[model samples]
Target chain A: MSLSDAPGPRWRPAPLLPRDEEREVSLHFVVAVLCFLACLMAVGGVSADRAARGWARDLRGEATIQVRPRLGETGDEAAARAAEAVAGVRGVTEAAALEKQKAEALLEPWLGKAVLQDLPIPHLVTVRLDRAHPATATDLKKALDRAGVDADVDDHARWLKDVERSAGVVRWAVAILFSLTAAAAAAVIAFATRAGMAARRDVVEVLHLTGAKDAFIANLFQLRFARLAAVSGVFGAGAAAAVTALIELVGGGQGFTPALPLTWMDLLTVSPCPLVAATVAALSARLTTLRLLRGTL
Target chain B: MSRQPTPRAAAAYGAEEAFDPTTGPVVRFQNVGMRYGRAPEVLKDVGFTLPVGSFHFLTGPSGAGKSSLLKLIYLANRASRGTVQLFGHDVERVARADLPYLRRRIGVVFQEYRLLDHLPAFDNVALPLRIAGRKPQTYRDDIAELLTWVGLGHKMQAMPATLSGGEKQRLAIARAVVTQPELLLADEPTGNIDPEMSLKILRLFVELNRMGTTVLIATHDQDLVGRAGMPVLHLNEGRLSRKATRRAPEPAAPDYGPELGPEYEPEPDEPELGYDLGDEEGEA
Candidate 1:
C-alpha cells in the first residue's frame, strides 16, 4: 500500500514551546503582541494627525508675496516695491519683511544657532492673509507683476504635500507589517501544534478507536494553544510597552524633543493585540488539526 | 446487498457453517478485501459472519492478517473490495461522520494493551463511557461496579505503566466492556498473561458472550481455543480453512500447568468489592 493509503496516525508536531516548557512566555506572548500593535497604531495615528493639523494651520493663516521688475528697475528696487505694496494691500494682517534674524531662528534647530550668524540669508516677507483661505501663489505672483515686483510666491503647499504623502506611506507600511507578523505567528503555532499531535499519535489513535470524535480531540489542543498564545501575546506586548514608555519618559525629561511621543490613545490602540494573538493561536490550532485529521485518521 | 459475484464466491468457499444458526450475526463480512497504499493485497476474498452473542476464536500465525481483519471489523480501516455490514448496517456505504457512533458500539483490546499511561485505571476503564457523552454522575456506579467485577477494584487509581502484566490485561478488558459494547474484538489478549490469568480472562470472555455480547478473539493459544470449544476460523497465507467439528479439550490443565494454588488470594491493598470466594470450585 502507498504511504498515503496507509495514512500515518493523526498526530502533528508539537509547538516550539510545549506546555511543559517555559510556559510563562507562551502565556505572556499574546499580551505583548497586543501592546506592540497598539503602539504602532497609536504612533501612526498621532503622526498623521500632527502633520495634517500643521498643514491646515499653514493653509488657513498664510499668503504668498511675489515681485516683478519693471523694464529698467533693479531686482532690489523691485523687491522693495513688492514689500511696500504688500504692506499697503487691503486686509493684510501683518506684512513684515521676513528678517534674516527670523529665518536664522528657523534654521537654528537644524544647522545650529551660530552657523546662520556668519551667513547671508535671503530677503523675504511673511504675510498673514485675513481671508478664509490663502490665495494661490500663481495669482499672487501675477498681482505682484502688475505692481512692478520681481519676486515669486512661497505658500509652502509643495512642502505640505510631501509631508502628507510620507505620513500616508508610513501608515500603510505599518498596516502591512502588522498583517504579515500575525500570519507568521499563526504559521509558527500551527506547525508546532501539528508536531505535538504527531508526537502523541498513539494517544490520538487509541482515543479514536475507543470512540473519541475528531472534534473532541481537536478541541483539547485548541484550548491549550489559545491559552499559550494569550500568555505569549501578553509578554510580547508588555515588553513593547515598556520599551516605548522608557523612550517617551527619557525624551520628555530631556526637553521638547522632536521624537513622536506616546499618547494614551496610541497605547490604547495596541490593547487588542493580545486578543488578536489568541485568535491567531486558535485559528492555527484549528486549521492544523483539520488538515492533519483529513489526511490521516 | 445485491447478488455480488465476490460475496457469492466467498459464501460458497468455507463459511457455510462458520456462522451460528441461532440468531442474526452482529457482523457479516462478505467477500472483503483490503490493501494498503500500492501494496499487494493483504486480506483477500474473506468472508465471515459472527452471530450475535456467540464467542469465537480467530486463529492465524503472525502476519497472517489477523489484525488487519480485526481492524476492518472495528472500522479502523475500510475494505477495498467488498461489503462489511456491522450491526446490520453496510459499513462501506456509511457516512464518515457516522463511524464514531458505530465505533462506540464495539470494544477492542490490542496485543500491546494500548492503555493511556497518563490516565489511571479508573479513567482508562471509564473512557468509552465518557466518549459516549455519559455524565460522570450518571455512569459512576456502573463503571465502579464493572471495575470491581474485573478484579481491579483496588487498582482504579494505579497507572497502566505500573500495573502488572495480568493487571494491565484485566484493565484493558474492563475498558473494553465498560460500555457494554455489542461486539468485542480482542487480538492476542492472552499472549502476555500467565496461564491461570489466561483462563480467568477466557472465562470473562465467555461470561460476556453469554450476556449477549458477540466476542471475537484472535489467538495462537491452541489450548485456550480448544477449551472454549468455539468454531475456529483458521487463516493461513491469506486463505481461510475451516476445521470441521472441532472438539472441546478437557477443563483441567495437563503437564505444562503452572502450579498456581487453587485458592484466590486477595492482595492486601485490594479494595473490597465483597466477592471473596475461597477458590474456583471447578475448571470451566
Candidate 2:
C-alpha cells in the first residue's frame, strides 16, 4: 500500500552541510581566539596611536632657550633678560626664566648629583608658543639678538620632528599588525573549509553530479563557515571590550598610565569584530570551495 | 593559434532563448579515451552511439571502466582523446560555463547510493529541483508524491544514516528521477537492494525510458539484464562490444530540446506526476 497520501506539515530542506561535526567546534574556538586577539590589537593600536599624537602635540607648542652670561652679568640676569625678550615676540604665548634649582631637578634624572655643583650651568628660559600660530626659531632668535642677550634659542623643532616621526612609525606598525591578524584568520578559515570539504566528499560529489554549479556548492560552505566565524567574533569582541573596560576602570583618569589612554569609545570599535570576521570567513570559504570544485569535482 | 566555436556552441551561447538545436544521436563517442593524471588509460579507444531514448545495460567486470564511461557522459571527467558528444555538442569542446547547463539534463545513480547524509529523505530527493533554483512550495507536493512513489513516503523525514541499505537505495532512485532528466545513468543502482526491489527499480527505469528518457545502467546483475531483454553494451578490459536486444527497436529520437539538452522529448519537462506507478506491475 502507498503511504504518501496525506502530506505532513510543510516540509523544508535541511541544512546542506552537517552541523554537528566535532571539527567545527574546534574551528570555532580557533577562529574566536584569533578574533579576540585581533580585537585586542585594534584597541591597543588606537590607544598607542592617540598617546603618540598627544606627545607630539605637546612638543610642538613649546620651546626652550639656554642663556649664557655676558662679561658684566651673572647667568641668572642673562636668563631673565632672554625670557623678557622672547615674551615680546609675535606668537609667543608666555616666556619664563628657569631657576637653577628647577633646572637641576630636571637634569637630576640623567646626570648624578655629584657632578651638578661643580659644573658651570647656563641659565635657561622656557617659552610657550601659541598653538595656532607658534613662533618659529628665526623669530625667537631675532628677538634675542635685538635684546642684546647672549642666548641659544631652541624652538624644540628637532625634538618635535623626532616625536612626529615616532608617531608615524607607531601608526604603520599598528596597521601591519592588524592586517596580519586578519590574514591569519582568513588562512585558518581556508584550512578549515578544505578539511570540511574533504570530510564531506560524498555530499560534494552528489551535488556536483546533480548539476549544481561550482558557485552553488561553494555557497554552502561559505554560509556555514561565515556563521561559525560570526559567533566566534561575538565572543572575541565581547572579551576584548570587557578587558578594555576593566583597564579603563582601574586605570585612574588617564587610563592604564598616561601612555595608553583607554576611553569608553574604544569599546564601540570592537563592535564590528563580528561583522569583519564573518566577511573574512565567507570570502575564504568561497574561494577555497571554488578552487576545490574546479580542481577535483 | 586560434580556436573556432562550433555553430551549435555559438547558438548555445549567443541566442540561447531562440536556439533550438537540431537533434541527431543523443550520445556519440568516437575513439574516446580517458585516464587520470599521468596514469594509464582506464578507458581506451571506446566508440559507440546512444540514440535518443534508447535503453541499454552496460555490463562489465569490476575494473571494466563502466563508471568511467558514464563519467564522460555526465561531464565529470573529460575524454583524453577523440570525441564524446552529447545532445550534439562535443563534451570536451563545450565551454566550462556551459557544463552545468548540459549536466542538468543528465541524472546519475551511483553504485554507492551517494545520498547526502545530512538531509532527510524528502529534502534529499528535492535536491535537483533546489539546485535548478526552484522554490520549495512549487515542488513540495511533487516531491512528497515522489517519495511516496519510491516507497519512502513514510521515511521522508528520516536521515540517510538512519535508513537501511535498500531504503537508502530507493531514496537515491527517487532523487535521480526527481528532475525527470533527458538521460539517466546508473552504476549498479540495485547493488544494495533485494531482488524484488531490484526488479521494481528496473521497472522504474523502463517506464522512464518509455517516456522518452534515455537510460544506461551499469550493473553486474546478469539476471536483471536478461529479464529486461535490453541491448547490452558489454565491456571487457577497457573495450566495448555490443549485443543485440530482444525487444523491437524504436525509431530515432526527435530533435533535441533547447538549452543544449534537457528533455529528449518535451512532454511535461516534469516526471510521471502522480502516475501511481509506485507499485510494480511486473514491467521489468
| Real contacts recovered, all predictions | 0.30, 0.53
In terms of lDDT, the poorest run of 10 residues in model 2 chain A is: A1-10
Fnat, model 1, is: 0.30
User: What would the per-residue lDDT of candidate 1 be over residues A95-198, giving only the tens digit for each residue?
Assistant: 66655567678778988867777765555666787655455566566666677666777877777677667767766777777677777778777876887788
Name the regions of candidate 1 deviating beyond 4 angstroms: A1-97, A104-153, A253-259, B1-24, B243-247, B250-284
lDDT of 2 by residue, A1-297 (tens): 455543455656778888756898898888989899999989998998888888877887899999988998988899899999999899999999999999998887788888888887668999999989999989999999999987887877788788778878887888888889899999999998998898888788878888788999999999999999999999999999999999999996678988898899999979999999999999999999998887853
Residue-level lDDT of model 2, residues B140-210, one tens digit each, is 88887878877887888898999999999998889889888888999889998997778778778878887
> Which residue pairs collide, candidate 2?
none
TM-scores for every predicted model: 0.74, 0.86
Candidate 1 lDDT at A81 equals 71
> Highest DockQ among the candidates is held by which one?
2
Worst ten in a row by lDDT for model 1 chain A: A1-10
